[model samples]
Target: MNYQTISITLLILCLPQSEANDEAIRLGLKQVELSKDLNGWKPVTQSKQIRYGEWTTNAPIGQVGTGGGWGNWGTSVVWEDYKTVTSNEFERASLNNGENGLRIQSIEPFVPSNATKYYQEELGSFIISPRIDLSTTTQDSLFFQYKSNTKMNLEIWISKDQDSYWGIWEENPNRFRNHISATVAENDFTQIKINLHDLLIEMGQIFCDNERHDAVINPETNEVYIAFVAYDNAERRLGSDPKMIEIKSIWTSSYYSDGQLQPAPIDPVISFDHKCSSVTISGRVGETYELQTSSDLDDWKTSYSFTLETYFETYPISDFQNTTMRTMFFRLKHKP
Candidate 1:
């Protein structure tokens, strides 16, 4: 069994780019700021409990609303006053809307534990989600609404293992399968939707070992875990403070509903780069495609099957060649 790997480390730093074309394969990032329709997709149910840590001051357990209904689970760690303690004042506050929604201030700086000794320190906080079922074949999607009075950086992470816990207090927290960054909000509740399969391909394991490995979600065998991490630097005032970024109404769903007419599949654009001796294909993310080889251009054999994590992908032309042939033809085919 040969599993494919997407290596961000080698792709950018180590991989050699050919001058055949001055440009490299690039994919336009999905726009999360725009509002999206549910498209008949149902909301994924969430367990109403915090997997780790206690609620911050003013944020009590079991708050209500779409945001508060899902449960607020968060923790914070700080390098403060020069002396560290178990008690934290800068942890994320959970708000009640029906269920508790996690909140982090972008305007107010955290007071140093020892204000006398040090002027500032560093603070890290995160809100984690309970295990949820997200499948690849069905085009499962994650949706959430967020409101921010100020700009805030948010790192979203996913893991297939249910036991994988991420907390600032943990000695060795588990590494998520993939992660991506996004701005929290633009002063109001903004709806965002991300396809699960697309996310795995878009963000391939960056927090773990340097070696390349497959980041897959096997719904039959595993449940998915997600976490949102935010950082604050008091020394430099590099993070959000007084204004808050609130996340609520988080859910997952299949891209289409039952009997919904599927959209027409788009064909992949294939081209050859003689200088690099490679074949490049540009296609939509999450769509599985195949590269085929033929001796006479009539009987083509499938050589490789892959889903585009990015908008554009390139493969060495030599990999599809079985023998030193005088002539060989190649084509790209969409899979279903």
Candidate 2:
């Protein structure tokens, strides 16, 4: 309750404040974290080597040849007797759910210049929505796997709204975005990681494609949406052949921090009063160190550089400078 007691208490509080600020600065420079496990993220479309809707649509359509039967012009089959050749080709196949109301189409391949046949439809399209979260402590990372029987290109869209009205993410227009054209190995699941910071830097606007792009940060409400489209243009040796693509998985994970600052696999030991001089530099192997000297703590100068060797080896300070009688403050920036 007296002045001495009050002064001591204030000093203790001030000490913690300085330490906290220092820790913040250290963490702010670099931060990275990896997910412990990846699961639960949903995929819009997941198929195997089968062409998009080929197994059910094109195959059945091919089975039922162009409807025409033996008949004479003069004595043609009666209109009433003619059975309506119903085709259940596409009906049996699974179609896109249209959650985001995004439209997908299959385009026929353009025939060679010499060929009389017009372009034949062979490719299929679909959309995928990757889960993402934007928060101070929680960061989102996206991973997905894709495989194709034939070479194909994947296009992605990111939006703040479900409707196609507002265009938030695009590749060709030179708008802020990031896309990688990966040549898929035959039937292989390609894993990809989408870092939150990288996405924001690339996309000038956050959740621009969503209706509430600007509101993503509001505590009351905010939403971000991402979609993907795939196009295949494999040549068909025979007419009515089917092409296929399969998306294996789509996943997202959260970590303790901003998803940066990886922890070291091994523990490190600490030592103090390391003597460094003009002839020698004292430092431990596999560690970051700073040689600081000060007549007063207010002003300090770094005299020698510290570097770790390949293997754990003792470094002598005799090579850098001669230790003077005065005390010097030397510290190591032990980054974990």
Q: Which candidate is the best by TM-score?
A: 1
The count of backbone overlaps in candidate 1 is 21
lDDT of each: 0.45, 0.35
Q: In model 2, where is the ten-residue run with the lowest total lDDT?
A: 82-91
Which portions of model 1 miss their true places by more than 4 Å?
1-100, 105-120, 149-152, 162-187, 202-211, 214-221, 234-241, 253-336
Report the C-alpha lDDT of model 2 over 208-281, residue by residue, as the tens digit: 33322332221101234555555555653335354544443344333223244433543332232232111122
All predictions: root-mean-square deviation over Cα?
23.2, 25.4
User: Distance (Å) between predicted and true CA of 262, model 2?
Assistant: 32
Q: 78, model 2: CA deviation in Å?
A: 28
